[model samples]
Target: MSVAGVGGFGLGRPRARRTAERASRKVARNVGVPLLSIVLLLAVWQGIVVFFHVAPYIAPRPRAAILAVTQNWSTLWPLVLGTIRETVYGFVIGAALGLSLGVIMAKVPVLQRLVYPVLVLSQAVPIIALAAPLVLILGFSVTPKVVIVAWIVFFPVTVNVLDGLSHVDQDLLNLARVYGAPRWRTFLQIEIPATATPLFSGLKIGATYAVTGAIIGELAASDGSSLALYQEHANSNLNTAAVYGTTMLMTAIGISWFLLVVGAEVYATPWQRRTVARRTWRRAGGESDG
Candidate 1:
């Protein structure tokens, strides 16, 4: 028996164990780093409040804000859900309109010229001012909130889609044409795939905007909105804990939306991960060689 044959199974066992260990470490880092960052932030916040002897009305300690969230979970949970519903409504409508409009403009140059300026002009107006009028016209209901969110979402997505369409690999498309592929096939196979990355980039941008739009809409509505409570706590009751807690919740919503879009991108573009890994491996090997 050869020496290599004798130790093949032993070598395989160690290789499999090392692979498992690496995966476990990656999972731990993903979860642990975020937790560590949050702990450090809260510790710093608590320290600042203590060191300055900050008044409760001006700024409460981190513990106070956490207690506010826990104690008011029943009331706050429903409000959070409502906010999420408004966000979803806005995102869906905005994304649909953006994709449709992007395709139309790409196909028809005259319409693109006529419509592009209007879209640009619409974004110029202050969103806060725009929200009030929408509330006045649409009334203090979910309609105004949905409109606000949708309007904010539409512009970014359209721009990204347009940019992506412009950058499709023309040489590849010409090659497909030479091979007798139909225009529809080339578009579906080449154009859409080219645009997926930028489309998701737009979605991520819109995700953050959607959160802000919902909150802005809520302030205008004056109904069961979290920001309303924040204003009341700050201006009337001088309750810093409630104010800080509300801000934290709002931040969480925005982060959640961004992460949700990121997850979609990861799932939709698996090849992107492989491409990134390949580049990293090449760079590492070059450094080692140097």
Candidate 2:
């Protein structure tokens, strides 16, 4: 077969392949740019501390931070574990509750009217302001941490999910009803699938908020109980490097968790991938035509 034989099926096969190669290059560029930026920033930070001869007590450098984290591994290990446990607990509980409430709010107009305003108002109230009360009511245990994480996470997921549900296509709903599909069936088949994009957005937002919630709750209840306690202690002792290290650790953990959820979203919503791919192909074909 000659090269022209392949053209019978599709003239733009070469064009499509070129487009895909360009897209892959774009993806690499996107990832590499940020990774390079971070690496550069760290290098600059390390250089500054070394050049300035910064005292470890006053302001420990990156090396000092790494050393502090490693040297105090015995003490930091337990605190890190506690924080992780609390964060995961809060994230899970909050996400579950928020998802349930969001589905209900979408289905029930009365509940939507009744609950949404209150939820919005709650967001206006600072989580820190109630941190003390949360501790007082829930005690200086894991309960408060989990509660705070859930509280922070619940709002974003609820709002996103509710919005997703509301924005579902009316035609789909009508079709479901015409077919005599049960409410649950319609919800699972039409509503949930429709809401996948927004739900994933909520999950990503909630996952990150989980860290903030855990830290706040831990700080409030800090009495040798959690990671925030140690972070606070390190800060108070002017162990700036340790503080920085722990904060970096938290950031890494949060980013990892969020990425995992995003990966799950991509995996579960293969339809979304197909839709995007189709659009991309169309766009590329049009561009090539032009």
Candidate 3:
């Protein structure tokens, strides 16, 4: 083999090795650190309960919470499913309405001036304060719960989508016009793609809020088969382990919804991920150089 070929192979080997090292480091930073932190937190929690002889009612140990979840899975699973269904329905409805309104407002200054202030004002009245009224009006059913979730989700989605749409590059629009592109074509090609990241950001926020809203609605409606109802029962009975377990379940649901939104964003906005990766790599390279 030629000396140049051997030199080329040597350089390629180092590059591949460097890429592997970077991937391993990223995995450690993202996964390993969080796992270690959770382990440490559990250890501290267990130690505190054991050493202080704390009553389980005050704060159950991590093991007790885990046991509660395992023991109550038969009862908890149905409630979890119910909450998930409500959340999904509300999120979908809210997102659709928010996206439509945002686009309309962005396209029409008159509508934006008329509607934006009303939205802001509506938010000033706390959601919880309206929960009882909603239950009264919608009856003690899933409708109120779904409405509450939709209401919680609507504001963030609308605001983010509007901001994204309104901030789209005027230069790009002008260029499209110069090229004789129709408004609809330009919007499809440029505006929607640009708005995706912000839209998903709003959705992620709404996703977590959706779970909270469903719980609040359930509490207000006194729904017997919901997770919130289960938590309330556990609290009243001084079953702290069950309460903690239910809380964990709610948190898991919210996080799962958030992750779904994140996954959608990553899929929809590949360029955004590439841009972030480039920035991360550059920053890491600079740190190494320093």
Candidate 4:
């Protein structure tokens, strides 16, 4: 059969132009807005410092903070690596636990009732309180820090996943069962797609928390090379530029990790993309954008 839908049968140039337009818009929305916002924020920050004659020791100008990062990069680079390592390790451990426990709890509602309260209670306890005790128990090493990060990551992932599993489309599930579809087949086709969005939502939330968890862990107990330790020293010496620089680095880490999760979600869940030109994006020759 002759092609009809895509590019209006033969108008490939129009279709290509539309695709390029969409890609340009996507780039502007994703990159341009944030870049503009940051520039505006830095401008306001610089203005406030200069207009008020604020002391550098109290609140350094944004330029000073950026300079601090460049000047002290030799000292900061190790701390960055340390924090990233802790985040990755904790994310792996916590994500595994969350996924496994979510499945178990969904399958066994009675156990969920019994154990879910304890999990909630654990979170209600302040991280500082939990961190101190954990340090005492796990010792003043990277182990305690990793455990703390994992603790922060576990709750959100488990909760989102459990909710996703419990809320899967029952009608579809029944149809699968009625037709005698194998359990594995039903899971791969139906359940996995059902849960993919929420699961990644949980993962993204966990990723944002990962760096904060590491910072908390480091504050609780860590060697001198960690970000928390570096920040503490800077604050004690009233080096506010360095303080802001470290804070900016921490924020960057959290944002970068969250973006990594988002990229993974985009790759793993095509159905969620749900775009008009998904066919065009896939470069299917003569295929309908519909």
The numbered model that scores best in TM-score is: 4
Instruction: Indicate the residue-level lDDT of 276 in model 1.
Output: 38
Off by over 4 Å in 3: 1-21, 275-290
Query: For model 1, how does the per-residue alpha-carbon lDDT over 72-158 read when each residue is reduced to its tens digit?
Result: 889888888878888989998998888888878887889999999999998898888998789779887788888889999988889
lDDT of 3 by residue, 1-290 (tens): 35656655544432223366887998799779988987998899899999999998999999889899999899989999999988999999999988998999999999999999999998798888989999889898889889989988988999999999999999999999999999999999999989998899889989989999888888888646789999999999999999998988898899889888888886767666353444534455465552
Q: What is the lDDT of residue 99 in candidate 2?
A: 90
What is the TM-score ranking, best to worst? 4, 3, 1, 2
Ranking by lDDT: 3, 4, 2, 1
- On the 0 to 100 scale, the lDDT of residue 240 in model 1 is 76
Candidate lDDT values, in order:
0.83, 0.83, 0.87, 0.87
Better of 1 and 3 by TM-score: 3
Better of 2 and 4 by TM-score: 4
Which pairs of residues have clashing backbones in candidate 2? none
What TM-score would each prediction reach against the true structure?
A: 0.83, 0.81, 0.84, 0.87
Candidate 2 local lDDT, 188-241, one digit each (tens)? 888988888988899899998788888898888776756777778889988798
Residue pairs in candidate 3 whose N, alpha carbon or C atoms collide under 3 angstroms: none
